[model samples]
Target chain A: MVLQAAIEKWSGKIAEVTIGAANAAGVIKVGGQETLPFLFSEGKIPNAPRVAFEVWDVHPEDWPPELAAAWGENLKDPFAWAEACVNKYQAQALCLRLQGAHPDYGNRSAADEAKLAAGLAQKFGLPMIVIGCGDNELDNAMLPAVSEALNGRQCLIGSAAQDNYKTLTAACLADGHSIIAESPIDINIAKQLNILISDMGLPLERIVIDPTTGALGYGLEYAYSIMERARLAALSGDKTVASPFICFVGHEVWKTKEAKVSPEQGVIWEAMTAAALLQAGADILVMRHPAAIEKVKQHIENLMGK
Target chain B: MFIIGELINGMYSNIAAAIKEKDKAAIQKCALEQIKCGADALDINCGPASKQPVVDIQWLVEAVREVTDKTLCLDSSKPQVIESGLKAAGSGSIINSTTADPEKLGLLIPLAKKYNAGLIGLTISAKGIPQNRDQRLELAATIVSACADQDFSTENLYLDPIVMPVNVAQTQMRDILESIREFKIISEPSPKTVVGLSNVSQGTSARNLINRTFLTMAVAFGLDAAILDPLDKDLVDALITAELILNKNIYCDSYLEAYRRK
Candidate 1:
């Protein structure tokens, strides 16, 4: 007797989202899969997961010694940092986080941040992901400026939460950029935010879900389960939850005590978090450490059997 | 829910006139309108007025095919009419129904298999509609067994617990709902379930209200598909909300508009 494997096929597909302008060196496209990640035999997994190096506009005083040493003085300038990431580090994309705009952290003007964004995008033609300072008020004030500066560039600008999404949604809609919808590790909020942003007339294809990452050993399972559930719901034909996922691997992983123990452990910690999320259906991983990104990139290639 | 639009049938005056005159424009228009309103498929019925159901069903299938590639459900009691529609439909169509009676099953199942179309099996026999859920289940099992014996995929089979009018069979409503949930357990990777939704509101004064409410309840009971009027926006809205509450559809602020667009 011959045995047949039961392959699970999905009725829905994850919406494919392109993150850069066509005129750029290259645009990064993610999520057009009809099945769960890496189940190539069951269905088509058209694109491999992408990795973006996280660049900060201001020199970071909070980053631990090992992480800070990886980029040395390049962290002091956004241009040097972005250039190194593109040319030296072989980075596929760059996520420029305007952490300097926070009141306590330099409180840089929106015009300055916008100039930095447009400059980096021009200097390095890779797909850009611009994120604002974590403060809601400050982000609202700053991201719109950045959105206009990068008009027609099609960068992935973030973080429209449930409480404050309209301004960023409207800006992204006008500026021709995609958005990252943030939920505090809650699937319902994640889906709800996607809906709210979409209601503003921004198509679902231009939105990526940020379910809010949690480091390994620090609520990783909770984040993993939420993402897994959301991906399954999407695959089962729920159009509202069908957008691609963007995981901030570096933001979550480097903050852990385990990462601070040793340099190799820190790299492993970040890489492991990303690897787990790739299995949980991460389309774009915003990471910090070059070593960790390399490790995860190799893992992705292996999983994709390239 | 897989909603099969019930508007293309000859029972409606517009469709009746279109069929009578072989007006392809009217039929195509109806097909496009239902699809725009979010119907997963359209049910093509010749109704009682058609003297030549065979030709009418074929013409209807061709007209609908010209407008959209959405699935068409060829609905008829006679196998020849269904076969004609199936021949015109090509593939990915559905056989609107066959009774649990082996004789009807014997003819329809092969036609369904040959055309690569889905089949809806009504859990009723020569005796008439089942009086209770158990009778419905028994007939469902018979249909499942028949499909299995004929080497037809059960996944392509949809078992319908014929919904009776609320005014006439009020007590049977609960039985019909229960039978829908039970039909899944009778077979592994269970066959899908459907209901001819308008039947429940057949003589009711509040037609739209009753239709939407029952459709919502049926959705909760795991009804997979329905032969329904997609043009009834309120009823469609209610159905979308029911699926949203059940977590089948993810919630959005403009979910009604979103569902229709989807």
Candidate 2:
């Protein structure tokens, strides 16, 4: 008897979302696949997963030596760091985190954060994902200002949770930008937050799922499974959970001991985490470390057969 | 679930008046409201009062189609009335149904194929509504076989197990639910299952509560579609939550609002 491979067909396609405005130097489009990640023979995977270098508005106070060494003094200024990410590292996109606005950090005002975001966007027209400080109250106050300053640029802004999504969702809707819905590694919460954000009048096409990343050996499996399940649901014609995934690879990977061993080890660890997530259907990877970004980009190129 | 809004039927006084007076505004308003409330399709029926049943159905179909291109289920017992609506409905419509009787199947299945529309088969025949799950399954099998003999794909066929009014036939409610589950296995790729959801609560007090509860239960039993009042916010919410819990839809905090928006 002859055996043939059984092909699986899906009824739904992931909604394709474009980051950055029409005139931007590079507008990264993600999530127009009708099949599971990397199953090229099964269906179309229109866009290769994107790798974005993570930058912070404020200098790091508790950076591991290995991670900090990658940027050196450039980290002291947000512009220099962003310039390096664009010019030197050849970043496809930049993920700017306004960490200074955190009350525990520099406690910068909303105006200062908005100014930084507008300046960086002006300097480089790459697709941008502007993330607020982890503080929910502070973020609600700060992100709207940033969203206005980057109005019509179509930047992706967020970390809007279930409890506090109204402000950011409205901001994104007004500014014509996209949002990143954060869900704390729970699939239901991830979907629920997407619904809540969308209910506030932001279109689903303008929302991305941030299923809360977990680095290698640090609940990575849990994060991976959630993403896999969500992707499967999306492909199975569940429109409610069909947005592309944005995994904060740098944030989660850098915090792990496995990634803090050495600069080389940290680079490999971040790359490994990113590579794993790409297979599990991560459309946007917000990563740190140039070497890791390059490595994952190459891995994505290979997997996508480009 | 594929929710077919059941409000545009002329059985309602407002719709009956609209049909008699040829009020296009009333029909269009009903169509738009149902679509706004998250109806995947609208069931168009002239009810029983129309002297010109065929013309009334065509008018309803045209008026509803003018507002939105959402699928219209052309509903009538007479094949000519359904055919008149189907002619005006254009593509992607559904024939609201046929019985298991060979003659009804013979007429409607060909019409369904000619119009490239879905056909709903009620698992009841000239013998009347099935008494039990097994009888319903047997009729469903007969309909499935007849469709096969005519070379009509079962994928486009929706099998309804004839939901009876709980006040009148309370014992058959469980049987209907069971029949819905069993209908899938009658074929390899099963015909989709639907029900006239309001039938379960007909003439009962707390109709909304009973309708929603039963609709949720039917969904759990793999009911694929329903003909119900989408305007009932609570019932729609219950159906949304049930599908979410079953993992048929991804859950969100404002899932009720989200389902409507979708």
Per-residue accuracy of model 1 over B1-262 as CA lDDT, tens digit each: 8999999988889899989988999999889988999899999999999999999899999988988889999999999999999999889899989999999999999999999999999999999889998999999999999999998888889999999999999999999999999998888879999999999999989989999999999999999999999999999999999998998766656678767766
Question: Candidate 1, residue B93: CA error in Å?
Answer: 0.8
Model 1 chain B lDDT-worst window of ten: B249-258
Q: Alpha carbon lDDT of residue A205, candidate 1?
A: 95
CA error at residue A109 for candidate 1, angstroms:
3.4
Which 10-residue window in model 2 chain B sums to the lowest lDDT? B249-258
TM-score of each: 0.91, 0.92
lDDT of 1 by residue, A95-192 (tens): 99999999778999999999989988888888999999899999999999999999999999998999999999999999999999999998878877
Candidate 1 DockQ, CA atoms: 0.45
Error of 2 at B135 (Å): 2.7
lDDT of 2 by residue, A89-203 (tens): 8888999999999877799999999999999998898899999889999999999999999998999998888888899999999999999888889988887887777667788
Which tens-of-lDDT digit does each residue in B1-262 have in candidate 2?
A: 8999999988999999999999999999999999999899999999989999999899898888789999999999999999999999997899989999999999999999999999999998999889998999999999999999999999999999999999999988899999999999999778999999998888998899999999999999999999999999999888999998897766655667666765
DockQ of each model vs. true complex: 0.45, 0.56
Model 1 pairs whose backbones collide: none
